[model samples]
Target: MKQIFTFLILGLGVCSGVQAQVDAVQKLDAVILSDSKLKNYAAGIKIEKLTDSVLSNNATSLTNLLAFNSNIYFKENGAGMVSSPSFRGTTASQTAVIWNGININSQLNGQTDFNTVNTSNYSSIDIRSGGGSVQYGSGSIGGSIHLNNDLKFSNHAETRIKTGYGSFNSKNLGINSSFGSEAWTANIGVDYVDSDNDYKYLGTDSVNENGEFHNLNMNVNLGVFISDKDILKLYHQSYIGERNFSGTLVGPSRSKYEDENFRSMLEWSRIIGKFSSRLKVVHLHEMFKYFENKDKDNYSLGKVNTLLINHSFNVSFNEKLQFKTILEYSNSKGNGDSFKEPVRNVFSTTALLNHKPNNSISYGVNLRQDFTTGGERPFVFSVDAGFDLFEHYQIQINGSKNYRIPTFNDLYWQPGGNLDLVPESSYQIDLGQNFNYPNFNVKLNGYYINTEDMIQWQPNSTGLWSPINIGEVASYGAEVEVKSHYNINEHQFNVSGHYSYTVSEDLETNKQLIYVPFHKGNLALAYNYKAVTVFYQHMFNGDVFTTADNLEGRFTSLNGYDVGNIGCNYTFFKNTKNELETGITLKNIFNEVYENVAFRPMPNRNFNIQINYKF
Candidate 1:
């Protein structure tokens, strides 16, 4: 027995040493990749991957791995071009989201709407919580989300096609393919969905009139590995969709909109003798059209076309300290009659330093400067520290000062919109801790944020939603999560859960911020035996308040609800040359009727089936 124990310990040591060597040679901060690159290295990544299943629908429309861990609240406005996510007490434009290391917010004027993205095209999706100003500029006040295509499976030439039908007359069709050699890879994907969401309405004679949505998405990637340490990638993605706006009017007219977003990325990375370099050029164009009534009258341009250019560099001079620098320049233009602004430009630079004096502790500091040709913007700065105690315990401390300028809609929006709006300034602090044992992981994060000059469109007695620079608002939040993975022979079990509570109040006036949830939680469990896997989940949303006034086109209703999902998977030929996986998903398993979004009531129980064949 003593000899066996000693041998096991020695084997573990050898494995650990090999893993450490592999980690040391890789870039620690950022990686340039397409979907093919992502899939080939998914398991070893620090990020998470949320999927509906193999070649099928995900939990919803978005892969949205961030939904599992971040403190962000967003409801899909499926019927319109504008999708908003509320972070802390800030608006949708405050948060930043990226794709393949590109700043999407800069190109879209600070909104990464989820309604249009097809989750099936992505290999990985991740969100970095709180103040990524060091690596990205502008819309990083709340946090940053990064997503990319998967490339690992591109080594072989394969094609996948999936189609499904469900409640509300929803239809979906998707196809994806990848081909590659030892030195080059290519991937292509196309997906389309059309849904007439005429679910059972509550207390109203008319069925929810305008809840129809149609979506189309495409993604393609080509890459070449020039050498062991040099790589170049070209990626293109686009989403074109039309949504039936949720907010309704008493007349026959229903809110509707069309959105087209397209992006191309050219990225190159090369490593030379203890130093590495990266460069990326991004081109994006978007068109947003909103119309009321079937005649397509009352057309309004929600978002105009825009372009962005971004770059970054990172170097590890020695073992103790590393350096990173980033720059971004963006130009925006609005055409069509609804918008008056011609064009705008913004640029920023940020520098960051990460130092680890010892193995147990590390500190990071970052400073940023920004320039906008049209407006006077404030500089952004932040600092963060991470401490590892006793190998399995960690603590992170962070603080940051951030600012946001008025969007085009907020500036010249006429009538209900404010023109003379100043940029909102905010300061925030966060404390986070996590502990991992051989079988379990526990994580907790507590944070506080204060904002002055919050911008909101509060209606006067006249019932108009007018932009107002409100007084300071304070918010404090806490989240706790735990996960465990256990294995016995060929049987396995996984369990995870998280809970978060948040509140925002006016500092002087003592009023609650609008439409911000105070509580959220998710629970998941999976059991595996032989070739079969069973998984179950429960997602809960706490109460949030919005305007009860019927006159307001936005925020006419809000509430809280809980939903559950159950799934099972079967793997055939698990150990053979042909591998196959099949699974099913049941959303809203309890048939609970709830509404987290106004006019956009929750969908009833839905079912999905998925299959995957591995080469």
Candidate 2:
């Protein structure tokens, strides 16, 4: 703890310097896609934007990038197997993942596995904290994560290639290229990663057996200017991966899982006078096969297909008032060995109004309603306001109602499926304050959420587990973030950090939720001197209870841990036409022994080297 404080003090006490400009590596010319809605309509929401430099530094996987940079907590079966997130103390299913303005959560499980997503494939990533059901739809009770691609229209062309070799025989390869003209634009990215993942378990002679895995991701985006007032865009993404589940300390097992995902969307936009409109057609497909034995051909298979149509219109009444409306329809079909085939159809409508009465005050109102064939639907609404209290201080507040419907596996599974389950509903409120200066920025936020009829799978009288409407739950938390950058001559320094305190309790038992930590934080520091850059990052996770009863035994809870990483990079052969850069990262420099999940030990100290070339 003392060392951590000393490091922070050193970063603050250095010679004062002028504020640094935005990194030259950022693609400032690109136009943001779906996130424009959030920026325009969500006046009081808290949004975090991951910069291009951060994305390039942690290009291996989304799990690695978020765990060190965001306030969300993650639990991994092992180093790179079956990772899930707990945002603001909410369950994994309560967090929504959006891709290209569409909700892409699994229809079978209602959640996304973070390990399967590659960070290098997307042009931008944004994290929105607080309930977002009014604009983003279901499974957004806690928060939402957005992955987007940007479109550029200019006479520009570039290509980048990167390769890396890491510990445990891990390898990474990535290629990205983009070209833009007066009439059209194209961007494509491909990434492949694999590992033998056989690290030795700390404090034990056993090794992480059967943990090898590999994944491939490909993304392509195209845009065409149809006319002076019309534009068309197309996006497609594919992901395929296979992994062997790691064995726990208690036993060894041979099991494998294979999955594939494909997504495509086409959109058209037009503007005339004060009115603008957009229409989108989307298709998504996901499939998975699980093998209990590595050598066996027999496996349980699941597949789902979804099609959606969405249209939205926006009109500006004046410079201070705006109105927007959206209508959407979706149909999904699921078939699997564990559950009977099922089909679901849903239709929804949303209305939004924004008013900026003056320069110091702004507010927005959003309302949505849904009708579904599977079960009853809920009406959700959100209200937000922002106030510029002074020159350097601002206050914001927001409240919303959110909901999540039951998944296919919850209602159609062979023996234990229950058809009577209802959607889970939640109400939440957030208060925030911000301080911005020339060189430093700070933000503080507090939030509370109450959920009714929470869904949980539990054993019944016949010892068969089935989904049921659990009681109520209450979750509250506070977050703090600080960032600053300074430049003196050719030397530059950047510092950023965030801390979260959370408490989630079950109304009946009055106990903390399992895997929900009470405190978590991380800090990052970087120094850039001409062609060389050095960086360090540290993360701290408080103890977490693994059991619902909040037991104190070693097998029931995990101890707190602190981990640090350091790296440096150098740029050479830099010129107007080409550039080459090489870097090395040492992860877990202190060799901290920790486990995200009980009985599942993480890897020890490791290192990786990467080289990148651009033209």
Candidate 3:
């Protein structure tokens, strides 16, 4: 399609999959919540063998809590929808979100936005910020979000059902059921959602453009306990969507787009006294089709398939000694009628050590290497440590040497894009402190990243933009978060907020990076009574943006606020064998109009209600 050999001259080797997650198995470094490290802990964030379903009615959005005072430098585009989730001045794609343990992102291609992912399917989501390579894997120069899910459990039956409708014609319906027995456990669930999102803009005759989003998700997990020391599982998940992206509520009828993805995993684990081993194989397929306009008459579509397999081991000799190792392999085939025949393989390995020398201190470090058949073969490494000082005080320090290989899209995004790009490499460091007191908690963190071979859509003297790696970048930022949870008789309340600020600049030209906010964050206060809760959400933004230089001073930013949400739940029936639950959600309660992202207009206040019964 486009000259595909440009980056080949620099990166060519038998690349591998991600290395293993090596952590101390010794009692000293062993961290457990509830029971069963792989089962319960996984439900919280670990990702391998989790517990509950996150999409249940009792669950909330991933950003629900973090949005309050957490984003510093978030930019809102003209049309309104929070353009995408950017962190510390980075674009959406810069922040990698992993579903399960594998990365679903299209390399540096930057296709799917963070918002495209509904945290609804996960049992819990873990966020690792600031070049956290050791904890995650590669492409984490910015940060990472990991989604944990529940595997099929035995001898239990549970069903979840919910329905809700709120402002701007938004509504959701979900039903999921799970069954487990001694020999096998099976789980199946489905979700349906539709939204007619429309919000008014400030100082404009045009209401923010709106997009109707329709989504469907299906997943199944089957597992068997082969023996007292061994277990095997099969996991399958799929998602489909029809999205409108014209930055308008009602555009050309044919303008909406569609996306479909499916994934399957087979895993086995064995335990013997102080040693354990695990193996997993995965297969994934994805397709994306979009229109140049709503007409749907003409569209450009693409598809990709990936097969990845991984193995790892852990051993503990005593309360202080532990060892771990991992290896993986992957093959990706990208073929689209309108694209190229991109094929490649990767290999990876990692080693780590974790120590809790005392009750007041804990730390860890790791070494990693990645090799790809037709891509860059970079050796990366990371180290981190967290200390609980004295009492109620925590301090964390982390750093990493990581690289992000350029994706095919960066060099081949069509007509005028460049295909001759170099991979980006960076070094990052972060330090943070936290204090927890009975009912109050506070956390403060500072981070910095220095990058070489930075990716850019540079404008040429002729005024056209082309992807290039001819620049360097430096990013520095700080975040402060505070939370208070207290109960007054029948009333309970949680007040939480965060303040984030980032300054990112190009080292080569001394200019600000594109589409990054200089300051952003949110504040939320929720009050609850028996079966009732009311929430007040406020989001704030500071000045910063990106656009054609021709509109130097024409850009508009948020120095504004948006009020969101109000809801209540009611229990109509309760018995040992039967129960009924109902609730409602009011979004944008005050009807205040605002946008968190550029070009995406969120609906004004809305309402939703749900009812559930058990037999």
Which whole-number lDDT from 0 to 100 does residue 47 have in model 3? 18
Candidate 1 runs further than 4 Å off: 1-60, 63-71, 76-83, 106-109, 150-155, 202-206, 226-229, 246-253, 296-298, 415-419, 460-465, 548-559, 572-578, 613-615
Predicted candidate 3 versus true structure: per-residue lDDT over 1-615, tens digit per residue: 012321221121111111122332222111111112222111111111212321332333444433443452333332212235566666565666666666676642653444445545655555556764433455667776666565644467877676666555667776777777766677777777776655454345655343667778887767777765567777788888787763533332335678788989887765566666667898988887877677647777777788998766655555554555566678887876445667767777655556656666666656666777755766776666777775888787877787776665665555444656766788988888878899998878888888888776767888877778866788888887778889989999888777778888877667666556566677767776775656666766655544423134534432345555666667677676666877776666787655554444445555667776665
Q: Estimate the TM-score for candidate 2.
A: 0.94
**On residues 1-615, what C-alpha lDDT tens digit does candidate 2 reach at each position?**
433533432332221111112112222223536545777898899888998878877877898888888899999999999999999999999999999889999999899999998988888899999999988898998899999888888888999999999999999999999999867899999999999999989899888999999999999999987776667899999999999999999999799999999999999876565566678999999999999998999999999999999877776668899877777889999989998589999987777889999999999998888888969978899999989989999998999999999999888887888899999999999999999898899999999999998888889999999999999999999999888999999999999898999999999999999999999999999999999999998999999999897998898899989999999999997887799999999999999999989999999999999999999
What candidate 3 gets wrong by more than 4 Å, as runs, is 1-83, 152-154, 181-184, 198-210, 247-254, 416-419, 461-464, 548-552, 556-560, 573-579, 596-600, 612-615
lDDT at 229 for candidate 2?
61
Error in Å for residue 467 of model 2: 1.6
Every model's TM-score? 0.85, 0.94, 0.84
Best by lDDT: 2
Worst 10 residues of 3 by lDDT: 40-49
lDDT of 3 at 598: 40
**How does residue 257 of candidate 2 score in lDDT?**
96
- In candidate 2, where is summed lDDT lowest over 10 consecutive residues? 15-24
Ranking by lDDT: 2, 1, 3
Give the TM-score ranking, best first: 2, 1, 3
Worst 10 residues of 1 by lDDT: 37-46
